[model samples]
Target chain A: MTKFTTRLPLIGIGVFAVLLLVVAPAVLSEHWISNLGKYCCLAIAAVGIGLAWGRGGMLVMGQGVFFGLGAYAMAMHLTLETAGPGALPGFMILYDPLAPLPAFWEPFRSEVFTLVAIVLLPVIVSAILGYALFKRRVKGAYFAILTQALAVALAVLISSTIRETGGDTGLSNFKYFFGYVLNDEANKLMVYLIAAALLVVCLLAVWQFNRSRFGELLVATRDAEERVRFLGYDPANIKLFAFVVAAVMASIGGAMFVPIVGIITPQEIGASASILMIAGVALGGRASLFGPALGAMAIGWGQSSLGSSWPEGWIYILGLIFIFVILFLPMGLSSLFDRAKGLIRRSSDEPGPATPELREVVK
Target chain B: MSVPDASLVVSDLHVQFGAFVAVHDVSFDAHPGEVRFLIGPNGAGKTTCIDAITGLSKGTGTARFGDKELLGSPAQKIVRLGVGRTFQTASVFAQLSVLQNLDIAAGLRRSPVSLLRARRGVDASVERALEETGLGTVRDLPAGMLSHGQKQWLEIGMLLVQDAKVLLLDEPVAGMSQDERTATGELLGRVAANRVVVVVEHDMDFMRSFATRVTVLHQGRVLSEGSVAEIQADPRVQEVYLGTAGALSGALAPGAEEVD
Candidate 1:
C-alpha cells in the first residue's frame, strides 16, 4: 500500500505527459493546437507561481516583470533576425529611417546571446531583487505591492519608448524563427510541440523540487520563519532561491510565448497579465503538482473561446469563475481528485483499531 | 569529548529596546549538565537577557560560548555556533509531520547540500531525539494535530536534533497539565545531562522541583542569584515574587509552606 501511494506521482506524470504531448496533438485542429500551445506557455509561468506564492508563500504579484524581460529579449532577437543584417527593422524605418539600430539591438543579432539572455536576465534580476527584498524581511502585502509596482513601471517604460520598443503599438510582424519560415503551417505545429514539451519539463523540475528537502524548508519557513531561524537555516536565502526559480520559469514561458503567439506586447506583460497568471494557478490548486498547469490552460481556453463570442463579457465570466473557485473550492480543482482518492481508500480498507484523539484542553 | 569550558558565560550584559533599557549589567555563568531557571515578575527582563545572549536581540558586553562570542551575531548564526532556542509559544511547523520536523532540524548540523539527498530511515540522532522526547509513538502524525504538551516536547526535540550545546526555552511549561509538567521536568533533567539548559518560566512548583540554580530578576537587573533554598529564604526575593506577606498565600506560597 505504501509503495503504491509513493508511486502515485510518477503514474500521474506519465498520464499527464501522454495526454499533453501525444493525445492532444493527434486529435486537436491546428488553430486549437496553437491555442493550447499558448496555454502551455502560461502554464509554465503558473508552475513558477505555485513554487513561490503557493509553497514559499512569497505572494509574487509582479511576475510580469520577468515575463516581459523574457518576451522582449526573444521579440528583439526575432525582429533583428527578420531585418537581415545592416538593414533596419520595418518599424524603425517608420520612426527614424536613418537612426542606428541602437547599441542594445547589436547584441541580440547573435542567437547565442538572445538565448542566453532569455534564461539569465530574469534569473539575475530576480536574484538581485529577491536578495534585497527578502533580506530586509519585506513580505505579505508590502512585497506584493512592490512587485506589482515593478510590473507597471516596466510596462509604462516600454510603452513610452516607441522609437526603440515600438511603444503602445508593440512589437509584431515577425517573418522567421531561428531562420525557419514562420508562415509555414508545419513550423507553427512544431512550435506548439516545443511549447507542450517545455511545459512537461517544467512540471518535472517542480516535481523534483517538491520532494527535495529545500521544499520542506520552504514550507516550514512559510509556517514559522522564526522557528526555522532558530533551527539555523537562513529564511531569507531560502526565499530568494525559490523566487529566482520562479522568475526563470516565467522567463522561459515568456521566451516561448513570442514564437507561439507571433507577437509580444507591453499589454501582455502588465499588472493584469501577472494577476491572470496567478488566477489560473489559484483556480487549478496552487499547491498541487498538476493544478497550476491545468488551471492556466483552462483559463486561457476560456479567454479565447468566451472572449471572442461575447468580447467584454468574457472578463465578467472569468471573474465569476475565479470567484466561484475561491469561495466554494478554496483548494481549487485538485481537491476533488484528493477527495476521490480518500473515498476510494476508505471504502477499500477494513475498520482498524480505534486510537484516542490528542486534543488540547486549556486550564 | 566536550570542549574545555563548554559553559556559557555572560558578563555585564545590557539589553536596550530603543530608548528603554530592558536588562541592565546582568552577569551569569552556566556550565554543561546544569539546568538553570530564570524567574521574575512580568517585564523582569528575563526573556530580554536570554534574547540578547541568543542573538535574538542585540546587547552590549560579551556572551562567550567557550571561545566563540555570541552577542553580535545574527540569530541563525548564533544557533549554528551551538546556541539553540525555543519560543515562548510552542512553534512547530504545523503542516509537516513530527518526523519531518526533526529531519529539517537535523539538517542544520549537516551540509547545506544535504537538502537534495533522499530521506533515509530514522538516523541515530533523530531516533534518539524522538525517543528522548517520548514522541516516537506519533512520529508520523502532523505536528499541528498534537496536543499543546506534545508540541512543546516536539520543539525541544528539534533543539536536541540540532546537536545544540546550549538550549534556551521560554516558558517551557506554561500551559501544560500537572502530569505533563512533571514529565517535562524529567525530560529537561535528561536533556541537560550533557548540555546547558536555561529555562525562563513562572511556575514556581516546577522550578522548585527541577532547578539546580535560580536567578531572580527585578526592574531589569538581577535582584538575587543562589540555590533554590537561598532564594526561598531571601526576604527580598519573596517581596518581589510574592509581593506583600498578606498577598503571599493568595496564589503563591512564601517559603513557609511545603511545595511538592
Candidate 2:
C-alpha cells in the first residue's frame, strides 16, 4: 500500500505534466488558452492556501494581502513601462493630478524589482504575521479571524488609497509585457505558459516540503502543538513557516494574475477574493497535491463562464458548491476519484468493503 | 544504588489571576528519581503544584530544576531544562498520525524550523520514543483514532522525547481499563529508572504499587509525608479517609478483629 501510494504520486505528476505542457497547448483555443492561463495563476495561490490551511491547519483568510502586493507590484511595472519617462501612470494622474508617483513605485518600473517584490512582499508580510501570531500561541478560530480581518483591512485600504493604489477601479489596460504586446495571441499564450509553469513549480516545491522532515513537523504542530513543544519545538515557528510560504505563493499567483487576466481590481484583493481562494482549496481537497490548484482553476473557469450570463447568481453557485463539498465530500473531490478507482481495482480482484451503491454498479 | 538529591525546592512562589491567589507561599521538594506521590482529596493544589513546576500556570514560586530557577520560564523552556509534564486531560494532537505525534514530541527538542525542511534522523528518535511507550504498531494510524489508554501512552511518549530530568505527570492514568492500568503502572516503573517523576494521582492502587514516598496535602497544606504504609497508618489520614474519627474507628474495628 505504501509502495503504491509513493508510485501513484509520481505517475500522477508525470501524467499531469504531459497533459499540461504538451496536450494543453496543442488542443486549447486562444480564448480557452487565455482562460486556462488565468486559472493557472489562481492554482498557484490555491497551492499556497493548501499548505497553510490543509497541512498546517491555519485558516489564512488574508492571503489577498500578499496577492495584492504581487499584483500591484506587477501592475505598477506594466503601467510605468507603458507611460515612459517622467509621466505618471494613467490612474495616478487621473486620481492625484499633481502628485508624483510614490517613491516606492519607482523601483517597480524595473522588471527585476517588480519580480522580486512579487515574491518578497508576501514572504515578508507572512513572516511577520506568522511570527507574531504563532509566537503568541494563537490557533484555531482566532487565527482565522485575525487573517480575515487583515484581508478586509487591506482591501479597504487599497480601495481608499485612490491616488496611490488606483482605488476600486485598480490598475488595468496594459499594452506590453516585457517587450511582447499583451494583446497579441502569442503573448497571451506565453503568459498562460508562464502561469502554468509557475503552478507546476509551486506544486513540486510543496510536494518536496511535504516529504521533508519540516512537513511532518508542520502536521505534528497542527495536531499536537504541546507535544511538539515538549519535544522541544516551538509550534509557533513551524506553523509560521508554512503560513509564510502559503502567503508567498498567493502573492506570486496575484502577480501573474494581473498579466493573464489583463486586470487588477480592488475586488480581486478583498475579503471575497480571499474567501474564494479558500473555497477552491476546500473544494479540491486541502491536503492533496493538485486539489488546491485544480480546485481554484475549476472555480475560475466556473466564474468566467457562469458569471457572464448570471452575474448575481454566480456567487450563489460558488457558495452552494462549497457547502456541498464540505457536507458530502469531507476529503474533497480527489477522494471521489480515488473511490471510483478503488471500485474498478476491486472488481478485478475479490469483494472488499463495497457500499451498496458501489456493489450495484459492480454487478 | 545511591540516589541523587530528589529535593524539589520552591521558595516564595506566588501565582495570581488578576486578584485571585491560586498558589500562595507553597514550598515543597520531591527527592530526585523518587516516585513522589502528591495526593490530595480534592482542590488541594495538587495539580497547581505540578503546573507551577512545569511552568504551565503563572506562579510566583522559585521552582528549581536541580539548581536553576524555573520561575518566569515558558513551558517549553521548562521542558528543555529537563522538566517534562502531562496535562490533567489527555492533550494529544488528535488529527496527526500516532508516529507523527511522537516525531513532533521528539522533534520539539530541536529547532523545528530547520527540522521542518530536513527529513532524516528524527524518525529514529521518534521510533525509539514510540517503542518506549509501546505505541509502535499504531504509529502510522491517526492519533484521534487511538483508544483513551493509547492516547495517554502517546502523551507519555511525547514526554519521553523531551528526555527531561524530571517528569511532572498529572493524573497519568485517570481513565483506563484494568489491563491499561497495569500496563501504565509497569511503564511508569520503567520510566522512573532515570528521572525524578512526580505523579498526582487519586488511584491508591496505582500509586501504592510504585510510589517510593507519598506526600498528602489537605486544604493547601502538607498533611503528611512518609512511606505508603507509614502515611496510610497515620490517624489524620484515617480521619480524612473515613470522613470522621468515629466512622474511621468503626471501619477499622472489623479489620482489627479479623487480624486479632
Instruction: Tell me which residue pairs clash in candidate 1.
Output: none
Give Cα distance to truth, residue A174, candidate 2, Å. 1.5
| TM-scores vs. true structure, each candidate | 0.95, 0.89
Q: What is the CAPRI rating of model 1's predicted complex?
A: medium
lDDT of 2 by residue, A1-363 (tens): 857976676677778777777799999998888888888888899999999888888988878888888988899898888887678998777767698789988898888888888888888888988898888888889988898899899889888888887888888899889878999888888888888888888988888788777888777777667666765566787788888889888888998999888889889988988988888889999988888888998898898899888989998888898889989998789878878987777776565444433453234
Q: Write the per-residue lDDT of candidate 1 for residues A45-130, one digit (tens) a residue.
A: 99999999888998898899998998999999999889998788889999789999889888998999999999999999999999
Chain A TM-score of each model, in the order shown?
Answer: 0.95, 0.92
lDDT of each: 0.87, 0.78
Error of 1 at A108 (Å): 1.0
Which tens-of-lDDT digit does each residue in B1-260 have in candidate 1?
23457888889999887788888999887877778888877778888888898777889999999989998999899999999988777899999999999999998766767786667687788999999999988888889888899999999999999999999998888878989999999999998888988988777888888999999888788889988888878889888966766322232321221100
